[model samples]
Structures are given as C-alpha cells and as structure tokens.
Target: MNIKLSVVDQSPVHGSHAKIEAPRLTVELAQLCDSLGYHRFWVAEHHDSVHFANPCPEIMVASIASVTERIRVGSGGVMLSHYSPLKVAECFKMMATLHPDRIDLGVGRAPGGTGLTSHALAFPHEPHHGDLYAHQAQMLEGFVNGTLPADSPYSTIKVLPDSSPKPQLWMLGSSGGSAGLAGHLGYNLALARFIDPDNCNPAIFDSYAEAWKKAGHTGEPNRMLAIACICAETEEEAKLRAGTAVYRKLAAQMGQREDFLTPEQVQDRYKAMSTSEQAFYDHILKGYTVGTPDQCWQEIESLAYQFYCDEVSTVTVTHSHHDRMDSYRLLAKHL
Candidate 1:
C-alpha cells in the first residue's frame, strides 16, 4: 500500500538543556522534515508543562510556514475547547492568506493542559461540557468558508484579511465516537493512534470510512493515522530507546502526568519500578514501532494499510535531538 508520510513534532523539552532551547530544537527539526520531503510538518500544543514548550500552535504554524517552501504546516492540533471558534477561524484564515494551500487546522476536543489550565484559558467563556467541540467546529467551518448563519450572533463578525482560500480543517481524536463526529461534520479525521495503546481494533477504521460515506462525503475520504515511531541502526538500540515511553507510562500510572522522559529519567524510573509496574511495559509498547528503518517501515506500513489511512503522521521522541532527526531521516529513506 502506498502511504504518504508526515510528522507531529511535540517540542519535548527534555535533555541536558535549558527550557528556552526547546523551541529552537523544534524549529530545526521541522526545517529538517520540510527539506526531507515529508508531506506535512505538524506541531503540538501542550501547555503548562516542562515536557513540551508549544502552548500556542498557531504561532508555531506561522513560524514553520515562514521557513518551509513545500510542506504543509499545522497544529496536531489546537484544542478548540479552550478558545472561541471565530478566533480560531480568524487565526487560520490569516494563516491561509499568507501561505494559501499550505496550512492545516487540526482541532481537538481534549484540553491541551491540566483541568486548571483549561479553566484558566476558558475563564471568561465558562467551560461547558457537552457538544462544545462539535459546536466550535461547525462555527469554525462556517467562518472559514464565509457561511456563518445569518441569525447567529457571530454573523456580523468578520475575519480580517480574508483571502481566496482557507486552511484545511481536520478533526483529531483517539476514539471511534470522535471519528463519527468528524465524519458527520464533513471534516477530515486524524486518528490519535499514538495515544490509545490497546486498540488494535480495525473496526475503528471501518466505522470511520462508513461514517464518512454516511455523512454524504462524495469525494474521497481524507484522513491521517498518527502513531509513535523510534528508528535506530539496530533493533536492540531501537527497543532500548522505545523503553522511554514504557517507563513514562509507568510513571503516569503512579500519578505523574508529565511523563515524557529522557534516557536518564527512563533508566532511573525503570530501575525503581515494582514487578507489577514493570509488567505494564508489554501493554504500553503495543502501539509503538521500534527497529531498523526497514523493520520500522514494515510496521508503519501495516498500520497505515490497516486503517486505510491516506497519510501517516509519526511523533518521534528520543533522548538525543540528533537521534530524533536521524530516526526521521532514516525512516524517510526507507519509507
């Protein structure tokens, strides 16, 4: 099966470095992906955390677009629950105006940070629980296309510097329920396969495809499958590096949410894990791919075909920034 490749750079702020250097590492990595012929280069938004530096994805998107020539730059995604739909539309509208056809707006239901952070972001708006993302998504779509309902309060609001085209919108989720919502709304879906480690269920893809057609999508289905990847020269090295996530999962099980670990952190945590905690590694590593480039590509290919995903976006994290770049470079060479 032929599958396009993209990236989700989370700007993990780890290693023996200062926090400010994280953004620079992210920019350099994105530039490398752009030059390496990757289809898209997406950034993530994880606020109030020492692990990730990018809190506002729109800014990162702009920064990426400025330096790249061909690749699409986008959020992987922006948590719509924390902001106004009109504001999001306007932000991406300005982005589209600048980079026309080179921008993506991937929206998510998950709040990027903790509950307190989400509360702070949504303070004036007063967070509502049910159907918030669906509402925001619809409004965003309408504004992006100048189709806002006349009776709606935001009808009079206009996106400044609107242009001929707008950013392509995508819905990101880890569950079939969210997939169905994206389909019903006629938006593209980006499944967060990286997060849900236990679901090898192929029915999720079947349901998403069915939902796309059921939602009256006449054109071809546009979607992406995202997963974790770790590539090294040797399978042993890959497996060793892949244990970072395993240890991080164990840490999370122990109530620490900031679980993106560096190599040192992983080693320390792994040594301290109890037998039961160590047992969780098998389950945690299920969704991840780690090996030589050829081995890694085979696994990635299987995942893309299983989901019938048009594009595969990988989020690669490792102890060394150079190793992370090498992982991507090697995967590109083979994939």
Candidate 2:
C-alpha cells in the first residue's frame, strides 16, 4: 500500500509556552511540512475554542499557498452549514485561481463549533434542513459547473478569472451517512478516523467502495484517511507527548474548557484522575497511531491496506512544534 503524510493546521495551543509562540509557530510548521515532502497540508475551521487557533480556513489556506510551491493546500474542511453555497464556490474559485493546480475543496456537514457559535456565524433567518448538507453540495456543484439560471442573482456572477481548472472536491465525514453519499456522488472521501474512533471499522471503507462501484463510477475512488499520528525516536518519548494530547481531549470530553495544559500539567492531571477516567482516555488513545517511527509506519500501512485507502493524513500534537515537525520529517523519509 502507498502511504502519504499530511497535517491539519489546527495550531493546537497546549499550555503557557504554546501561547507565547502559537502564531509564528504554526506558520513555521506549515513551511516545514511543505519542505519535508508531505503530500498535502489542510486546516480545520473552528471558532470560540481556546485550544484551536484557526477560525477562518480560507485565509489560512491562502497564507499557506502563498509560501508553498508543490504541496496541495485547502481546508480539512469548510463547514457547509455555516455559509452560502455560492459564497463558498466563489471563495474556493478565488483560491484555485491563485494556486492553480494545487487547490482542493473539502466540505463537511458539521458546524465545527458549539450551538451559540454556530448561530453567530450562520444566516439569522436561513432555513435549516435535515438534508441541508446534501442540498448545499448539489448547489455548490451547480455553481462550479455554471449551470445556475442566467436571470437569477447568482447566475451572471461568475467566479472571476476562472483560469484554473475546477478545484478537486472532497466530502469529509466521521460517519457512514456522509461516506455513502460521497461515494454515490463520485467525489473523493476524507474519512475522519481521528474523530470517530469507536466507529472506525474497516467495513466503513468497504461500504464506500461498494457504493462507488454500484453507482457506476468507473474511475478508482480516492479515499484519504485522517488519523492522529505521533512518531518519535523512542516509544517512551512518544508516549509522553501523546499524554499531553490525551489530557486535552479528556478535558474537552468532560466539559472542562479552560487554559491549555503543559506536559507536566498533563502528567499531573493524569495521575490525579480516577481509574474510570484513566480507562476512558486509554481506550480513546488506543485507536490513535502513535509510537516509534517503525511502529507508526507499520500501523499506518496496515490501516491503509485494510481500508484500501489511496492516502493517509497524519495529524500530530506534540508539546513542541519542533517535535511535531521532526515527526513528519521521519515519516516522510520512510514514505
């Protein structure tokens, strides 16, 4: 199986130290990833979350595209429920015009924020539907294909220049519903293995492939799996760094959103946790691909072969940005 490395530029702020360098550190890491031969670099859209720095994925994509030459740049995904389909089409068209062959547009149905934050960003009176995502996706395709009515508000307004070929589009999902829809529609799939650890059975990918074939899509479907990957020189050090990530996830799951914790703080918190809490954290971490470089490569290869994936995107969170970059560098060498 072929393996590729990619990063989601969430710019995690893990503690007091991260706050001091998060801004410049994130950009530096992006450059490092580009130079390290990673296949793609994407950012997540988030708001009102102290742990995540990127709220506007479009702006972030522009910044990264400006600095990199070969690496593909795009959103890990844009939350479609929060914006108009026409606006999204125009925004990505602008990105495509700038970067030409190096742009990708990944769309997700989730709001990527809490209820209050979602309301703040969405249209005040816009109607919400149970199948809003599917509808928006169809509208986006129409806008891209220039099939909208000529007299309508969005008809005459073509995305400017339109020089670059339409950007490669992908559907992002953590569940089978979106996977099935993406396959039926013949679009690429970005499976969120990191988010829905409990439900990440190999059958999910099998279902996607079967649906793709049944839908008469003759081309091979491009399936990219996103996983939490942390590789270090030694297993002990990797585990220590992973502990910090575990602590942050636990805090979020427990509804305790506050300042980020340092490695020491994370260790202390883990020690003080009840046995049940520790067990829960351990269970979640088990699904993650973390360990020494050799071990990581094996796990990644196994998953890719089992799922018949075309690519693997690694999402890493280390206490130091340098460590995170180093992890990618190591993975790239093997790839």
Best-matching candidate per lDDT: 1
Error of 1 at 58 (Å): 0.3
Poorest 10 consecutive residues of model 2 by lDDT? Answer: 122-131
In the range 1-335, model 2's lDDT, one tens digit per residue, is 55777777677764546474665567777888888888888888877888777778888888888988889998888888888888888888888887888888888988788877876776476436325888788677667667666666666766665623666788888767687878777778888888887787678777888888988979887788899988889887787778777777878888888765666777788789899998988887897888898999899889888777868898887667767777888787786
What TM-score does each of the candidates earn? Answer: 0.94, 0.92
TM-score of 1: 0.94
The parts of candidate 1 lying over 4 Å away from their true place are 129-131, 257-265
List of clashing residue pairs for candidate 1: none
Question: Which residue pairs show collisions in model 2?
Answer: none
Q: What lDDT does each candidate get? A: 0.81, 0.79
